[model samples]
Target: MMFLVITVISTFVLSNESSRIPFLNGDNFSDWKDKILLTLGCMYLDLALYVDEPPEPTVKSSIAEKSSYDKWKRSNRLSLMLIKSHISQSIRGSIPPSDKIKNYMRTIEEQFVSSNKALASTLMNKLSGMKHNNSKSVREHIIEMRDIAARLKSLGIEIF
Candidate 1:
């Protein structure tokens, strides 16, 4: 009877001691939960950033290659632009215009304006340097011009 009592007491003491250790405390559990939540939140934000489809590859050198690349780029660009345009049109079509939609359209327009300016500058630079005799450089310049033209076309702006 004495031995049983001693054993029970010792077991209780050991358990209590172990539970008091910092590693086994309630604070550790809360810390772990916080870390897990932070990691998941970061992953969610990263996914949001890439929800849009990737831009199509644009570097190519042959007629077939150029055609395929241009087709893919144009398709992707059109898809993105259509998505934006549809959102704006839907807002304007509604009986009550949504401020949220109006703001979204404004943001999209601002982004497009800046992008167009950048593309125009790049095209002008490429055009200015057309005298290069290197086939590879000329091919790259043509591809750049094609991309700039496609981007402009997406914004309903024609580049002659």
Candidate 2:
């Protein structure tokens, strides 16, 4: 058998002069060579018995397969309508009815009440005696946009 041939060859290689150079004592040379040959033979036997096959690749659905655009479009439209309704109600003297937004605003107001009050007072003073104006300053518009985005995010809404 292949095992018998490998064992004989390993024994012969270990018995060679170069292999015996590591063991200066002749008394333990045979024992050391036997241990080395046994270890090498075991390693060869293990390698010969090993089963080698490539691992199978995991399959995953493509984006289009996983996401149906039609369903998403319908849901997105409903969400936009809900946001618009909330904004319209807020603009028409109706404080947003959503408890989530109210709670979020309460937390923000508690944290930044002094700063917010000062900012609001300054804005009111600026607009107090002004004629009808058609233009918005870039800074004011940017703040408004940021506030809108923050409100949306606080409501657990995914913008993207």
Candidate 3:
């Protein structure tokens, strides 16, 4: 439902939306996913937390029960809109157009996010070998480390 609102509002505001709206580019899927999550947080959406799909109503279901089904469908539409609006054209072109948010999110995750095991191993190596060289100030080193930590945290891989 929120995505519906975002999309409607965006229609007016978006011309070269992808260019003007700052988001994760296709160059680094992991980075893009992390930034998008934070952006969602500001809007009170938690993509990280699991949300089970609403159960489909049966033929004998009451009117109110059927209404819940409609809401579920609407919610997924909103989710897809959010995902579509933020990605680069290069990435967007590859996405199979779908109404189900789960499918849209899953497809992107599988293709771009890569295997978490590999990402975690790579990040762990970076963390283990972290060093502060004399060429840069201590502040720069700390800031760089923070960036790494944030990335790790965003990907659900804890390095601490």
Candidate 4:
């Protein structure tokens, strides 16, 4: 009885942790990707992200090889599902589907990397054109400027 309760609670906690990954809308890919990677790592499901797929087990495979293969397979399957589940439906249609987690992630990165260049340009223009305008508190205005700078930095652009 105690074991069953612990199992249920652990499952819920894990699910909740994954749920914290933000839905990948078209504009928020960078933030969404960061959260997804972090969440997968926390769940110990990021093995597929770092390791290439192992060859299928053969009849004479050693126990350790089989164990490693099984672990990689499970991680790939669950990580793929967790990633796809968090993508918004509108964006999902454009991504080429794949059973291999690495391929799927590559497709996602390809789709975003190009747009990030354009996004950086836009942010640069906005940051340069921004002015105090006297409508908001000076603190709020400075914070907003800092946020734009931070976003630009995340895209590999540094003003200094």
Measured by TM-score, the strongest candidate is 4
TM-score of 4: 0.87
Model 4: lDDT equals 0.89
Residue 109's lDDT in candidate 3: 80
Candidate 4 error regions (>4 Å): 1-10
Which stretches in model 2 have alpha-carbon errors above 4 Å?
Answer: 1-67, 89-160
Candidates 1 and 2: which is better by lDDT?
1
Off by over 4 Å in 1: 1-99, 137-160
lDDT of 3 by residue, 45-124 (tens): 43322455657899999988787667666556655666688877877887788667767777888776565556667777
**Of 2 and 3, the candidate ranking higher by TM-score:** 3
TM-score of model number 3 = 0.53
Q: How high is the lDDT of residue 27 in model 2?
A: 21
TM-score for candidate 1, please give it. 0.27
Give a tens-digit lDDT track for model 1, residues 14-34: 444333333212112233323
TM-score ranking from best to worst? 4, 3, 1, 2
Please identify model 3 stretches exceeding 4 Å from their true place: 1-62, 115-131
TM-score, cand. 2: 0.18
TM-score (all chains, Cα) for each model: 0.27, 0.18, 0.53, 0.87
Clash pairs (backbone) in predicted model 4: none
How far off is residue 7 in model 2, in Å?
Answer: 73
